[model samples]
Structure formats: C-alpha cells, structure tokens
Target chain A: MTGVSGGAGAPRLLQVAGLSAGYSGEDVVHDVSLHVDEGEAVTVIGSNGAGKSTLFRAIMSLVTPSSGTVTFDGNDVTTTATHRITRMGLAYVPAERHLFGDMSVAENLLLGSYPRRPDPERLAMVYDVFPRLAERRNQHARTMSGGEQQMLAVGRALMSKPKLLMLDEPTTGLSPLLATEAYRALAELKAGGLTIVVAEQQVPLALELAQRGYVLENGRFTLEGTTDELADDPEVQRAYLGVA
Target chain B: MISALMDGVVLGLQYGLLGVGLTLIYGLAGVINLAHGQVAVMGAIVVSLAMEADVPAVPAILIGLAAAAVFMLLVDATLMRAVYRQEGESRILLGLLIMLGVGFVIDGVLEWRYPIQQLGLRIGGEPIPILGVPMSTGSLLATAVTVVIGLVLVVFFRSTALGRGVRSVIQDEQGAMLVGIDPARVRTFVFGLSGLLAALVAVTRAMTGPVGVSSTISFTILALIVAVVGGLGSVSGAFAAGVLLGVVDRLSSFYIGTYVTTIILLLCAAITIVARPAGLFGRSH
Candidate 1:
C-alpha cells in the first residue's frame, strides 16, 4: 500500500466535511466526512445498506448534501450541479453502469466528453486501457457481457480525462476472475496517478487497490486506517473479509 | 391510385416532421405536450394573418415559425417548469393536463379572434404533371421544405455536440447528468424544436390545403397517432409510420370514403400498439 504522504501539506483533491444526504426526506448518509489527496487511491468499504453509494453521490452532487461543504481543489462545490462538478474533473460511475443500451459503444464513450470537445488522444488512452472495448466499439452497449460493460463504463468515464474518478459497487455482480481483472485495471490506473474514490462491498479487492480504507456502517464511517491496518483488524476481517 | 399514393407520400413526410417534435419531447423529457396541435394552429394562423397584412410569403412563414418556437419556449419555462422535476406516470399525466389546458386556452382565443375561417397559401405557378397526374406546385414546395428540414435534423442529431447531448438525455437522463449535460436545458431546447417542427407542419398544411381554427384538434390526434405508431421516442420510426399512415389514409379515403379515413388510421395505431408496444423502431423500456 502507498504511504499517506499527503498528511498535512499535500494538496487535497476533494474534501467533504459533515455531509448528510438522502432520497426524498429520509437521510441515507449522515454526517460523513472524508478527503482524497491528489494521486491517492481511497476506498470506502461497506455492506449494501451502509450508505457508501450515498456518500459518493453526495460528493458528486448527484444527491444534494443537506448540510456540508464539499471543497474540490480549494473551491466549495457542495451546491454545484452534477454536470458542473463533472466538468471540474470529478467523474462518477454508478452501480447500474448506465450505458445507453441502444447506442453504439463508441457513441456512449463519446458522450462522456459532453460539453467539451473530445480529444483523440484521450479516446486513444481509453481504448488502450480496455482493448475489448475497441473491438466492440461499433456494437450496441447492450450486446456486451457484464464484464465488458463495466469496462466500457470505466472507459467512458476516462474519456473525460477526469482527475478524480468515483466508482460505486464496481465489482458487485462479477465473477472472481472478472472481478480481479477489473481491479487490476483500476490498480494500473492508480499507478498512473489518477486519484480514485471507490465505494465497494468487495473488501479484499478494494483494500488491495486502495492505499487507505474506510469502513462505513449505517450511514457513518465506523473505522478508517491504512489498508494493511484494516486488513489486520479483527472486526473488519470477521465482517467483510469473511475470515472464519 | 398512383396520384393518391404520391399524395400520401407527401402528406406522410409532413406528418413525420410533426411527429418528430412530439417524439423528441416525450423521449427526452417524458412529457406529452397536448397543446402541440394548437401550437401549430397558432403558427398557421399567424402566417395567414401576416399574409393578409401584406407580408411576403417567405417573411410570413419565418415569422410564424419564430412565434411558435418562442411561445413554446415560454410555456416550457413557466408552465412545464412546475413538472420538470416529476417522473414516471405522474409527470406524463401532469404534463398532459397542463398542456391540455393550454390547448383549450389557445383554441378559445383563436376561435374568438379568427372565427371559423379556412386559410391557405396561393401557389403562383401551374401544377406539374407527374405519371399522368397533376401535382400542385404548392404541395411540391411544401414537400421539398419537409425533406430539407428532415435532413437538417438528421445532420444535427448525428454531427452536432448539442444533438448528441439531447440523445444522451433521451437514452438516460441520470447518465447524461453524470457526464455534465443539463437535462433541464436539453428539455427546453427540445420543446423549442417541437414548436419549430409544429410550425413547419402548419406551413406545409396551409400550403397544401386550407386549415381552420378547429383543425388543431384533428392535427393533434393525427400527430399523436403517427408518433405512437412510429414508436414514441424514435424519430425515424415516426417518419416511417407517418408515411405509411399517410399512404393508407389517402388510398383508403379514395376507395372507401372520406369519413372512414380517421377510423382506419386509428385502427392502424391500435394494431401497432398491440403488436409492438414500443413502436416499430423504439427500444422497449
């Protein structure tokens, strides 16, 4: 795991302080606070109902934070629109994948660069990351397998050249081998200095890819530590790592 | 029979233009603008009045088109804004009711001011002979305009970034928003486009034949039928279905009777709904 050198002076890419958000009037995420420094890979590991997704949504401004300040690159963006937040270099990939099923894979990737002219070099980089996507570029997104679709979703986000990429439950329905493949791709991306905030139920993979981990339970972060520390923690192993 | 078929093809093209706007609105915003027909009537009436006031044909048509686009944009900004955040069945129902009320208001004003008058454009040149049939010059001009508009729209959706954004919204609003496309702005632009298409339909209809104030209801019904039969959100489907229905309507009216045309069109719509609820080219939700 990469050491947390950002400690006090390193520039924070995203800072969320006291964020509370939910659907309708019910709060799903309560007073959650976290920060990701530039080039750091952070993971929020939790169960299905632990509000990990909500926390990510709140940070992306997909869900309005009831009371909080989300500072991105020293600018307060708690109340900014989702698209504006995306334009400011924060990209989010939801659990559903949300690929336009009827559209071609290329079209879906191109749409990620919306409100901005698509750069061929960036597109080439996405293609280089996921060679399977390049093979099926002309095919409809619906035709791809689950693993391929997930890759396409990630590739599409990369098209925007986002500085920080937030992913929700990326390995939810994947087989072990496919899940490993996805995590390896993400690990490669992290090595390239892309700051990542991944919310996942897959504890081992998330911990393996992220330098730091946060254990969330019932809309709040129950524990936070370096990946090695959390992996060694008894409670985390018993609950998430499935250690008997 | 050949002439009837040709006439149907021309009318189908016009109906396709009309249905594209409604389909786009439904696809992107999930709203059915019930006042769509009335808006077209408003445009035709404006053109008629303008021509009566000695405005040239080109200028009058342009003015009417502009008026319709502006009016619909205003409607979207003020009235539709109330239901912009709504979703699913409630949003559709609310939009339908609100636009229906708008339609009634517009109809009332038009009737009071214009009376039960029939207005049409005059074709300057002689009718062209094609395949032993005489085609009115005005119909040919209207058909040409319809083709041009349709091509332009195709290019817009295929090539332009804004058009791609609109398509993204239609496919998945949440996904589009995640990528930083404003769904609200896209909806507003779609509403304006819908109005422009409606105005084009009005101009074409007026050129081909006379349009009365009460004709708005028929136009709305026909446009809805065409849109649904083509598949609600598919523009190409709308165009195909429009042309098919147009040909059917003309042929059936020539053989069966004028009164039976509406019944036949409705029956075709019913069949389309029963066989493929998503329309011919629509992706089934």
Candidate 2:
C-alpha cells in the first residue's frame, strides 16, 4: 500500500516474447507473445478454451513454457516459477477467485505479506484503498458474497506491493453491479499507476476498462487493437459486442 | 497396578505429540510422514549425543528441535514439493513410500552413530517432590518440556502470522497463493515442524522407553493412529486425541494383559473412525 513506485524510466512491467506453454502433454499456447507497459492496463479477450487462462498460467510460471522468454521489471524470468515471480512484484489473482474461504478475510489479506512480512505499512495501504475490507476484515472470506470475495482477491494481491497485477476473469462470476465495481477498482488502480493485465471473456467491458485489448482464439492472437478501433471493428461487433 | 497406569499415561503423552505433528503435516501436505517416529528417535539420539558430549540439557533439547525442523524442511523441499495441491489416497500412499525411504536412510545413519543403548541422562538437580510421587529429575524435565511445547504449539497455530499463514494454506492453497503466500514454503515449514515435534517425542522416549530396536517406526504407527483418531489437522483435536489415547492405553493395559493392549487400542481407534469419520476431536474435510 505504501510502496515506493518504480521510477518513470523503469522497464515495461511485464514482457512476454514468443512464449509457448501449456499442460505436460498438450501444447496449448503456440508462440504467443504479449506485453504490458508501466502503468498500462491490457486485457486479453477470448472465447472458452481460447487459452486466456493458459497464457496467464504460463506467464506466472505455474505452467512451464514450451519455449520463449518472460521478462518482468527487466529480469529474465522465462524459467522462474510462480512464487519467484510474485516476490518480484508481479501478483497473479486467478478468476476462480481463490480466497482462503476458511480464513478470515483479514487473515487471507495478511497472507499477501508472507514473502515480505514485517511490513505493516504496505498492508495498511491496501486497507486504505478498500475501506469495506477494513470493515469486514475479521470475517471469513468464504462467508462473503461473490463480489466481496473478488475485491478481497485484488486487495490481497496489492498487499504484495506488486508493480503489476494480473487478474484472470475476475468478473466472470460477479453480478452486473459487482462487475462494475470491479472495473471501477481496477481504474482506480490505473489512476494510482499500477500496471495491470486482465484476461477476460466480456469483450466490451474488458475494452472499456483497458486502453488496448487482444483477441485470442485457439491460443493465438486473432486480433489486437485500441479500444475504440476494436469497438468499431465489424468482426468485434459480430464476435464480441453482438451487434449488427 | 498403579505402575501400569503411570506407564500408559507417559506413553500416551508421547503419542499425543506425535499425533498433533503428524495430523498437522498431513492436513497441510496431504502426505503421510512415515518418518515421524524415526525423527523422534533422531531427536532423542541427538539429545543423548549432546548430553554425552557434555552439552547443556536445555540446549540439547533445543538443538534436537532445530534438527527435526531442518531435516523435515529438507524432506519437503526435495520430496514433498512436487506433490503439492494434489488430493488423493494414492498421494498419501506415495508419501508413505517416500518416507519409507527416508526412514531407512535416517535409521541407517543414526544407528551408525548411536548404538540402540538406553542412556538416561538424569538432570543434575535433585528430584523435586511432587504429589507424593518419587520422580527423578529427568522425568520432571521431560514432562515440563512436553507441556511447554504443547502450549507453545497451540499459541502458534492460533496467533502468529506463520501459523495463520499455515491455516490459510490448509483452507485453500490456490487462494492463499493469489494473496502472495506460497503454499510450497508453508508445506516445507509444516513438515519440518512435524519433525521437530517428533524430536521432542524422541527426547522423552529416549529418557523413558524401550531402546535398541528401531522403536521409532513402532511409535510412528501409534502416533498415526492418534492423529487420525484426533482428526486430521485440528489443533484442539490433536491434543484431545493424544490425552484420550494416553488414558485409554493405560486403563486397557491394566485391565487386560500387555499382549491384549495393542488389540484394544486398535479396536478403539477403529470404532472411533467408524463412529466419526473425521475424529473424536477433529472435523473431517
């Protein structure tokens, strides 16, 4: 929360080049590359089985890359595993929105400081952004509503003091209002200059929150463009916005 | 006989500690640590070695704890790390097989250094009079140490960031990770902590129990039963189950013959599993 934001000349927060990775037997992501600059919000929109989640997993090092390099904050992290990446100030919050349901919301949030414990100021900053979390911090995360859990997941990531926050389909299970709130929170994060990446299925909403969007089909970059241009594209209209 | 009851209580306390450690490790790592008993033996051997070398008794015990922690940490880092986030009875079996390797390895090494000879290093001080019992200095030290460790573990699970981190992982590893807590590290520490607990049991067991034979393996089996009986990973459950087993072990041995004691305890454990699949003191997942 009270992080010393990186310098302006700092390298791109996340850079994935020629990254190909997937499960042990099957090659899910085929030589796909992506990047998110400092203070940038990028979203990857894809249909089911389109490799959106797989890309996130590969970048996070949960899934081993078949080949290619992933650099974060100017470090060659192509082979680094998930926790190593997290400690490097890159936090990945999954869409399944895994929050330690059995743990109190506050306890779950506190865990974000494990790698860098004894840092209370950062934790206090997370609470500052989400006042509701501070209010219900003592309550178990599982008992909270779907939207609250999503918020908690984001807050927990912030506790890591990540320069970049990557969320996988955070709004998939949320209500319309909750989804909007999620967008608002992410925007607030952008205003505060935290680089972000969101892998989403909601095309228009994803475009609205992010400055640029990437369309993924069958694990390849089917289309990439600015928010305005994609919104106006006929294919985008047909495949995503569902308009004539 | 009063002697029979006392012996049972002493044995039961040791079982309780082993059970707590085993259940905690199992809950967090989902693997059966067959080396729990051997770790205990290693602790006792370390302590005895330290004592024989004129190391202070208190430091000797602490060193044993540290040894257990470090050894278990290695086991998790090297062996158990790959098996994280997978849940199945087979995983448990695999864990047992792995520990089988660890057990033989540790026992083989320990046997070389410390022959299985009973060496009771009595505390230098005189035996303090307690409730009309003719207890020696060593017994008092062992009892006090066990009780203190039990209390510390309780506070740890409920209070410290380390303990809470552990609880969060147990509840949901993936969720815990989203918040930046690495389940892998927690599992390593928990497994090591289990080893430390085994060491504590070893110290007391060495002070008062059979020696020469590979007694660590036998006690691990007992500890596993107590852990399962107490319920997997329940803090209160481990302590409660340990005490109950201790009492049951004593009473049954006194009423029945020593030969039948094992049978009675096994029956009790089986009935408990049938009656409450979770445990007497724990809730099943």
Candidate 3:
C-alpha cells in the first residue's frame, strides 16, 4: 500500500494502552501500558510468567484482551485479528518459534513473505544482515545452532519488511558468547532505527541493547526510564540484573 | 494380463487423486476426517439428483463438486476445528465421532430418498470390437482427472504464494500468523479444496453404487485407509498408496472374489501401518 520501508515518517508505529488480557474468560495481563515508537528500540524485562509473553500475545492478538485498547500505525486495532494486525506491518517472534524444521532455510525465509509478493531486494537485505542464513540457505533450519536459528527467525520476520518487529526473546537459551553476538545484531537493528519491543530474561544484555526499558513485575510496569537509569538502580539490579 | 495391468494402472491413478486430499487434511489439521468419504458420496448423489432433474452430466458433476466443497467447509467449522487445536488422539477421536454421526445421517437420508440401487455413467472407449477386453472409459476419465489435479497441486504448492502460505501455515501455525497468514483461514481453504477433489473422484465411481447418501460412509472409509497407509501429510504418498491399493484390489477380485478382495487389501494396509507407523512416506508429527 505504502512505501517498502514502512516505518519512514510513521508516528508511534505501535501503541498499547491499559492492555489487560489473557486466555478466554481468564485474565492474566493487568493494566499493562507500553509503547513502541516508530524506529525506537524498547524492551520489557521480567521473569517467566510475569505476563511478558502475554503482553506480546495480546499485541499480536493471539490472546484477546478483555479491556484497554491497542492502536497500530495510528489506527484503532484493538479488536483486529492477529493476521490483519500483522498485515499492518508488525511481525512477532514467539519463544518456541516456527522454523519449518523439515524445510530448507531458504524455504523457511521464502515463506515469511507469503502475505506479499516476492521481492529480491527484501531477500538480499535479510541475507546481507545474516550471512550465516545466506550460506546455509539450502540447509534445514532445524539443523542450525540455537544462535543461527534465532537469526533465521529474525531474518524471516525481516522478510516481511515489517515496520515494527516484536521479539519475545532473541537470546534465551543461547551460550554467553552467542548471546552477546545476538545482542550485537539486535543493537545494530536498533541503531538502524527499526522499532522493536523485545522481552527477555537476560536483563543486562537486553538493557545494553535497548535504549528505553520497562521493568515489569507480575504483569505490571514498576519502573520506566532510559536504559542507563535501570542499569544503575540497585533495586532493579538486585531484583532483575543479579548484580553483586 | 496386460489389459488387467493397464486397467490396474488407471484405477491406481484414481486412488492417488482421492488420497491427496485425505493426506493433506491429516498432515495439517491433524484430524482423521471421517466425513472425508461423505463428501465423495455426496458428489455422486448430487450428480444423480442433478441428472434426474435434467441437468447435464459435466455441469451436474461440477455442481456436485462445489456442493461437496461447501459441505466440507461446514463440517470443518462444526466438527474438525474444535478437535484440531486440542491435544493428542482426543481431537482425532472427536472429529471421527462427529464425522461418523454425519455419515449416519447422510446414509439414512439417502436410503429414504433414492432407495438402494446401482447406476453406471460410462465414458471413453466402447469395448473394442474383437479385443475381448472391457476397458472402462470411466477409469480413463479417472486417470486424466488425477493427473491434472496432481500437477495443479504441485504447481500451487511449489510456485504460488497462496500455496506457500498454506504450507507455511501447516509447518508452523503460530509462525505463519506472525507473518500475516491466518492458520484458520488456510485450514478452511484446504479442507474445502479436499472436499471438491474427493467429490469429483466420487462421481467417476458412481456407476457401481447407488448415488444416494448411503454410499458415503464406505467410500470415505476406503479413502481414509488408503490415505493413512500412504501417510497422512504427503500427497504423493496418498496418490501412490491409493493406486497401489486400487490395482491390488482389482487383481485380487479376479483371482479370488470381490468380497475377499477388500479384506486382503485391508490386511496389506494394516501390515504396512505396523511396519512403517508413519505410513509409507510420512515423517513423524
């Protein structure tokens, strides 16, 4: 509909206000409000089951929110279906992720743009970012290492030319060195001005990668500020960062 | 013997076409789809009913195929969807029960309306004079349809965006959704296509059956067995298994008897299942 670089001049690509949601008839997310401004890297940090994943699912519309509203690309998409929202230029990466394990890596990435026509330029862009993907393009994604698979997941999302990319955890279960490398790629994307919302258990890595961060505990936002504020705060350090 | 082999080859082609849809359903939705046969049976019923009402054969069969497709969509919405998202054999068994119920209702309706009877729709060649061979034109038509459908499915899955989207949905529903493809809509489209294909194949087989709803159950079960033994998700496997079963069944009928033929084929299928577990070409879930 619009230009390929969808985030250009777009204001507040994703906005979630008072987003309370969960499974059918069972609410887990409570009064969670967050925003991913166009081209701004944001992170939501919390322990497992703190409703971090639920918030992402709610934004993705996998789980319907009973209250509050979600606005994407300046449109009221509170009740929109998951696909329609995604079509609006938001790509979500879940925890278990879908890598088309039996399919070749090229096939997996090729499928990411199924909603739109094939674009050689887009494929080149993804390949350029993740060279490992280009080298193993013919191999099955399942055969790749954890870090490579994560690259595949992110690369696949990028194939859609998304305005906003929401990743649940880009570095979980990765080796320390691999995790650092993953953070570098994520930081590079942030520097390139791709609006992102990443939720992770690895606090120091996430804060280092994200400019603005929210400290979420039990489905509620407790602290919100520049990454430097949270990194230096002893309360956040003891609670999340595990600093001595 | 050559004629029999040729005839068997033609028959096998038909089974391959029918099995493709069955295999796709099992592989993607993880539903056993007991109602799969009812869709085929209904196609024959539609053709017979249309002909009785003065509609031409081709148009009538097309209409029948469309109706079967729609019916499949209905069954998916009402029966298949609930179980597909559930856990284990629970979903499979639930879909089986619902489809079984639908089959019974269709049978009772057909029995009451058409009365049990047999009518044949002949196509292609007349028994070649002096050849002493009875090559069914119907079988030839069946082969042609199967080939076309197979090629079309291949192109669709491999070349088209919509087809890739369907496959993507099957591989990872959640992942596909993130990229703007809804798994539910994909499932509906696939199931509807399956219904249309199964129904078309059923019309080709109508000559030996009472085209009323009563025949739906047996035919659906036959397609299911062929599909399962071939492997649920692989269309090529379904096609191969279906033809393999069809030829063997036809040959056995000549050597033994018609009633004993199905039993022997079933035994072969059971043995295959026991041996491969994932059918012939299917990988694990």
- Per candidate, native contacts kept equal 0.80, 0.62, 0.82
Q: What TM-score results for chain B when candidate 2 is compared with the true chain B?
A: 0.88
Model 3: per-residue Cα lDDT over B101-148, one tens digit each:
877776676678766533357664664322566655665566667788
If scored against the real structure, what TM-score would every candidate get?
Answer: 0.97, 0.85, 0.89
The DockQ scores of all candidates, in the order shown, are: 0.80, 0.44, 0.62
lDDT of 2 by residue, A1-244 (tens): 1112224354567878998888866889888877777877888988889998989988887788889899998999888767778888999988887787767877777777664563678777777777788899889887888888888989888888889999999897888887887888888888888888998877777888887778888989877767777788898788888897
By how many angstroms RMSD does model 1 differ from the true structure? 1.8
RMSD of each: 1.8, 4.7, 4.3
| Ten-residue region with minimum lDDT total, candidate 3 chain A | A1-10
lDDT of 1 by residue, A1-244 (tens): 3335334466889888999999998999888888899888889999988998888888878788888889998899998898888888999999998888888889888888987788999898888889999999999998889999999999989988899999998987899999999999998898888899999898999999997888999999888878889999999999999998
**Model 1 fnat value:** 0.80
When sorted by lDDT, best at the front, the candidate numbers are 1, 3, 2
Q: Give the residue spans of candidate 2 off by over 4 A.
A: A1-11, A118-125, B1-13, B49-56, B59-91, B104-116, B121-140, B176-188, B206-214, B280-285
Better of 2 and 3 by TM-score: 3
| Per-residue lDDT of candidate 2, residues B172-242 (tens digit) | 77666655567777887888788888877777765654443277677777888888788887767777777
For residue B266, model 2's alpha carbon misses the true position, in angstroms, by 2.6
TM-score-based ranking: 1, 3, 2
**lDDT per residue, candidate 1, B1-285, as tens digits?**
999999999999998888898899989877887888999989888888888899998899899898999999999999988787687888999998998999999999998988765559878899999788899999899899999999998899877889888888888888888888999899899999899899889888888788878789888888899999999988889999989999999999999988999999999999999999999888676
**Where is model 1 more than 4 Å wrong at Cα?**
A1-8, B116-118
Docking class of 3: medium
